[model samples]
Target: METPASTATAETPRPVDRADRIRSIDVIRGVALLGILMMNIPYFGLPEGILGSLKFDHPGDANYLTHQVIEILFSGKMRALFSMLFGAGVILLTTRKEHSAGLSIADIYYRRILWMVLFGVIDAYVLLWTGDILYAYGLCGLFLFPFRKLAPRYLLLASLVCFGMLIFKGHLRFQDMRGKREAYLKVVALEKQKKKLTDKQKDDKKAWETVVKNGKPDQKKINDEIKNVRSGYPTVWAYYLPINTKIQSSVMYEVYFWDVIGMMFLGMALYKLGVFTGRLRRRGYLAMLLIGYGIGIPLGWWVHQETTLAHGDFGRYLDSHFLPPNRMTYDIRRVTMALGHVGLIMIIYKSGWLRWLTGALAAVGQMAFSNYVMQTLICTFIFFGYGLGNFGRLTYYQLFYVVAGVWAFQLVFSSLWLRFFYFGPLEWAWRSLTYWKRQPFRISQPDSETVVSSIQA
Candidate 1:
């Protein structure tokens, strides 16, 4: 028998070998990584302030059609899917470590998340992508390490609670908007009658004015933003820093933290149920596809249409009672759409008829971290002032061309890169940081090029 110390040394945990990766999960992750760009490109290529305006394009325009298709099919769906995958990843990492009887799980866990936090900062400040999700995910992941072992039911219950909180918060916002609109109307009536306004009423009128100003696109504001985005690197950094800080701080907690943690909990529960592992039957997946799409598509369409109509008038958009489905069904539609995607991807994976497509996607998924960062680099280069300076120039529909080009490049590059290497450049770096040692970066085996092919098989 070996000594305990020797046994510990022999059993040191390492990154999962490529052969052990679940192909379906990788494929789904790749789909999400690629699909997210469809939504993110608007932020990368347009004035941020105008993003909230529903009337970005007139009816029958290319932009309007593109917006409709994306909103109905892929709005929040990709983020939800990505969040679930991250949650599943937590289970995958901890379970493997536990089975191997390696070092303390918390030690490795926190170290990994902390490093991710650092990366998120770099992605935001250095890479100049303010919409980075890693920082928020890292923050939420801190609270997730302890709950890994919870039963699926309890984990789901926790997820539902988080989602419920989000819904309640959305309702409160709607009510607040209603209150502000009411106050503004009251103040307007008093002013028309030449009566004195109360202090509260004056404040409310001011608040409503602020809302309308922000919601309606001001050409001067848009011009200023475009000019700022087209300036040199230092100016660009200064312009975006506070915005990045706010997103990473308050907006992160108030908006994204709950969304991420809830999906994470749900993902963890699904993993425990073996859903991510392709253990769910074909009929079950079919049912998910049908029910999820059936519910999500209609709801999303209705919400989008209402939003389009309401946003045509800034005042109408701010009137809470104008649209019933706006924020109320947000979670329901996104979650269901994501479920539909999961089922659809699972069916394709199990069917094995789309090996060519799935094979490429799996390769992309395998290196998702590197690819995600790569996108930020590429988009910034194309649109930021220091690079191509195309910011605020592309029409809304034209943004997809950039997205498509990036998708093609990443699919091919990631597939080819992985044939000779065990990990993507960033993934290797991240693993090295997490394990406190440099990992083997290249594949030594003669058959390494066939790794993705095996998944296709």
Candidate 2:
């Protein structure tokens, strides 16, 4: 009979072999992480509602134009790219350890995801960022386990089906918005004629009025919100905690779950097809870039124009909001653009034209968990009342200055830190928790070769 010590040793999970780490995946993940900051900085520095409304207090200015460009290009694409990479990562982790000595891959993966969820809670609530994705990713990851074994084509099909469901849901929302707008207009017409409203009509009118008020916020409310954010950390947390809770618990599932899951499925398909391995023909990547940009850029530009044209007319704006033209094509546009980015990056990586740049990005990707949390910490300190007290003070264009500084710091910091340590501090901790054992932190001379060759490979 085996001793208890021997039995416990047999059940310990093996670590992921670093030699098999794919550099291109890291490069893409690095790019996605950086791109995410471009979209997130607006929320960090300004009101969240600014992105949705066509009319801004600073309309037609450089800041306004900059916001438009970010919306058109980066808003959803980076997150989609990140989700896809995560899907690919699921397969990588599971299969790589399938035959290793340990618990079943599924058991280990579930534990990993559970830990991720815990981290996400800290990120979302304690960190006070409503846009946190880690929790959502962790929840959706549980759904990806069974789908991991599906063939590439089937996985791609399932992804498309998921997006189809979102589009269908969008259509329903559009219809509901149209109905509300019609009811609001009818109530307006009755009031103009000095007619009395029924009790139900009175309630409907009140609700619609509230919606319109929120959609086109008055200056006082905006200023008050800014004041609250700039008051101090305790005030900021008190204000945002409930809002973040609602977002994380409900809105995220209702609006974003399908989008993320679909992207993950598509990502897994792409990985299985060898797209991330740099095995695609040059022509294939060229076609992806051309076709993706050809459709996405023009459509995005048209949406921007329509949104601008609809400003200042509440009814028309409400109509535009209800039937956003982009709803029909949002997934196509974002997915294509994300693919275009992938193609562009892969070409750069394969050509070896900018090893230094790619190498730095890969390092950032390797330490993505640490860098992601660090970004939240740094941005919250800079903009929230607790630190710099600069919330809502900067223009959209000015916020990019902060973004650039953070990017530079992370890139340089990630590169230098990796030189001495095998894993990032957070990565090391996450690994230790996942495996229930401490992982090596310092890079020995032989381990340094492993890191170098992994990058060169």
Candidate 3:
């Protein structure tokens, strides 16, 4: 009789080979991974307090313009694309497993995601990056398995529902903030007369004051945060951990969960509809590109214009975010921009003119897991206190120099690394842990099939 080890080997599901990888998905993933850095770099290099506020730059400044470009073109769009790609990966993985005779899908699936959760914790805490999305992705991924087999239409419906929930939640939060602001103003008017304040009135006044302070951050707070971020590792952790905790807890559930899940469902729907597989006609992609940008760009511009008009007015800034038009259209702008980006990328892929560029992008996408982590490591060393300590030193446009440097390095490194190795280091490790076995590491001389697989991907 065969031993238990042999039986387990025979039953265990294996990772997909390079030959089976979808080039379009890989290209998309690569683009999304790189685009994410455009937004994340500011947080890494600047004091957190100054972000999304007019504290750092006057209106119409070059720095402000740089921010506007990124805010409109990339910002949430990249992350949305990332979330959708993850959703597509779910479908891709399970669909492949359907033919894996004797394999336990749930056993493999849950184990994979659980390990991702562990990795996410490591990415956030150990790596000291508060903006890590792996944890949120892993958390959202748990619910995706059950919905894998749903039809495209049903998936689309579910996605819409999730997006709708986010809008509803935004409205409710806006109402609460508006009420507090009104109360605070009323208390202020009363105080002008030197009248006694009720306890509730005092509390209301305090709450709105706190909001104002956060929204229109003081220069001293920014300076102090800069100093803290430029300190040693322990000081950095202590200063930032509460931020991490709050983001991982309340913010994750309230905002990221719905945002991520909605994109995920949309991704699954698009995958079933062949959006990422080059199955959609060229004209179809063109329409998506046109329509997506047509709707999203103007809306994003309007929102940004209105918000920027607030300048130093805390209440007006709050109104911009939580009030009509801007509040309601946030999801629409992000989603449509994300889809528009996809269309543009897909059009490029299908055109097949820039083989050299697309090939490099595909390689980067293949090792996106590694590249993402590498970005964290490289950036922390470049900006954190213990390393070069360039935190808060770079201006907005100047930050992109760092981004470009990183992009060049990753593109080259990912392309070169794959030539010698079958998988990226982290990808290899993740696969090993998920399957509970060591996996092949180095690439051998390629056969015809391997070459074909490489070309196809």
* lDDT for predicted candidate 3 compared with the true structure: 0.85
Number of the top TM-score candidate: 1
Clashes of 2: 0
Q: Can you write out model 1's per-residue Cα lDDT over 108-192, one digit (the tens) per residue? A: 8888999999999999999999889999889999999999999999999999999988888887877787778888998999999
Residues 168-189, model 2: lDDT tens digits: 9888877776787889889989
State residue 288's C-alpha deviation in candidate 3, in Å.
Answer: 0.2
Least accurate 10 contiguous residues by lDDT in model 2? 49-58
Summing lDDT over every window of 10 consecutive residues in candidate 1, give the lowest-scoring window: 448-457
Question: What TM-score does candidate 3 get on C-alpha atoms?
Answer: 0.92
- Which scores higher on lDDT, 1 or 2? 1
Q: Which stretches of candidate 1 lie over 4 Å from their true place?
A: 1-9, 52-57, 97-102, 198-200, 317-324, 448-457
